[model samples]
Target: MGILVFDDMKMLDVSGPAEVFSEAGRFGAEYRLTIVSVSGEPVRTSIGLRVPADAAAESAPPFDTVLVPGGDLLPGTPIDPDLTAAARRLAERAGRIASICTGAFILAAAGLLEEKRATTHWQHTTLLARSYPSLRVEPDAIYVKDGTTYTSAGVTAGIDLALALVEEDHGPDLTRDVARSLVVYMQRAGGQSQFSASLQGPAPRTPVLRLIQDMVQADPAADHSLDRLAERVRVSPRHLTRMFRSELDTTPMKYVELIRFDMAKALLDAGHSATEAATLSGFPSYESLRRTFARHLGVSPTRYRHRFTTTRPAVDATRPALPDVPGNR
Candidate 1:
């Protein structure tokens, strides 16, 4: 794995994945890690930490996988042309290419993400879509894999993406071990929206709207229909719908659905059965919950639980034990 680093890059964007791959090596996985930059010098991170580079981009050996990490690439901020060119060259020669967060911008600039489904930090998704219209920018995905190229959202999503790559290259057993070592969920229960739901919608403007939002969140099972909500707020149903559209930019029913979905997901993540979660989250029935999950998440509750659950199978006594690592014992 070759990770390209540069000035102002997010430190976790590089170190998080590096630690996962490094841990996999301890578990008997074969991974060769190298950090490179346009120049061979150490690069300062966005948080002011300096990390030494292994080699200059031009001098680096060929890699099976190349990752470009995100940086402070805000709007009107200039990207280094030399770095972009080097990334393009490395991507062309690598078996697979991936980007973390705003690194997708570099890949897009390199022409590597053209006509591909990709993602970046939610705050920057619009810019990426606007800048590279040919690229299908998925704002809410944790990560997207299109053929040999992969792109992920935000900084910590890099770890999730790296874990997924490890799972593909190794297997679930080893991947689970790595996740256990990291103390992170084997996989996140949902997409980036789970972490950024507040940012997803416009803030409630009026006190009535705010109160209704809090009520729905506190009790998703309550009557949250337009008529019921209007009654609670002492407004006409038409006026309530207009308020939701103007302030939330969504219908009242849509807001209720989002709240119910979040509540259901929380219950499922807590190890609740689908039927139990559905009934508790006001889905009417398990079938209703399943349909809602499939329509919005494109995955069944069972599948989501299987992927995201931290539970793992008992270790096989016959298999060789993992070697002890310093500080772990």
Candidate 2:
């Protein structure tokens, strides 16, 4: 498979999945992992690092499958037309195509995602849908495989998608072994938002914002109000609102809602009852939790768990065993 890393890329978007593929090769699977870029030279990463490419786009060998990685940059503008055209061409000939994170933006821009179901980082779902009206965006999944195209949400979720690919290409047994060797769980339940906590609420700047962050993290289930939070942090409500907008690029209420949903999903995945999870995560009631779940994930909480927590048939069931290649293992 060929993994393409574009300029201003997120490093983990490719590396995490590449690690899974490398380990799969170690377990006797045949893989040809190549990194391609528009120019043959190394592309700088978002985290201030560089990764060298195996070949330039013009001279790169054909690939059986293609993977595109995304970054923190905006997806709809300043993209290389040449790169988009190349991706379109790659999708035509490749057996399968996939994207990690906002790389779905590249595919959608390439016209590859039209009429196909895909997922990107949940934060960008509305933007992606608005930008590409033809593409159907599903936000509830960690990774989505629709026909020959695949897309995943967020950054590290790419690793989970890659393991699923290995499971499809080889079998569950080998997939399990690779996961065991990697020391990371092969599958994550629900979506990327589940694992994320408020950590630092809406990007702290002032000491007051820092205090508010601490309060949110300490008691996520509390009935936090703007006035109460402002009093706790010794700031006026108007001043607090301005600071939140300037630092977090979001409102205080919205940030609290994100934190509540994030923590609630985690608790639900940990086997907590929906009512308990709702209460613990600061939602007013279970009905409120259900409404938010439907709005953000497009699924009822029960349906989301049922779809993700349940297992599916192995992909290798209809396939023959792979032929042994000399020196492959």
* Highest-TM-score candidate: 1
- 1-329: candidate 2 lDDT, tens digit per residue: 88887778998998899999999988888788888887778889998888898887777777777999988884667668887887887778777889999999989888899888788987888888899998878765677777778888989888888887777677767777888799766466434342354543445767877787677767988868998888877889898899888888777887788778888877776767788888998899889989988777655566544423332212233444333212221
Which pairs in model 2 have colliding backbones?
Answer: none
In model 1, how large is the Cα lDDT of residue 38? 91
Clashes of 2: 0
Q: At residue 129, give the lDDT of candidate 2.
A: 88
Question: What is the model-wide C-alpha lDDT for candidate 1?
Answer: 0.80
- Candidate 1: the clashing residue pairs are none
Compared to the true structure, candidate 2 yields what TM-score?
Answer: 0.65
Q: Weakest 10 consecutive residues, lDDT, candidate 1?
A: 320-329
Candidate 2, run of 10 with poorest lDDT: 320-329
Candidate 2: C-alpha RMSD to true structure equals 7.5
lDDT of 1 by residue, 1-329 (tens): 78999989999999998999999888878888899999878999999999999999988888888999998754346678899988987887787889988999999988999888888988899999998899988887888777778888888988888887777677778888998898877876324342534347667879988988898888888778889999998999999889888888888887887778878888887889888899888888888889888777666777667765432212235544333111110
Local distance difference test, candidate 2 = 0.76
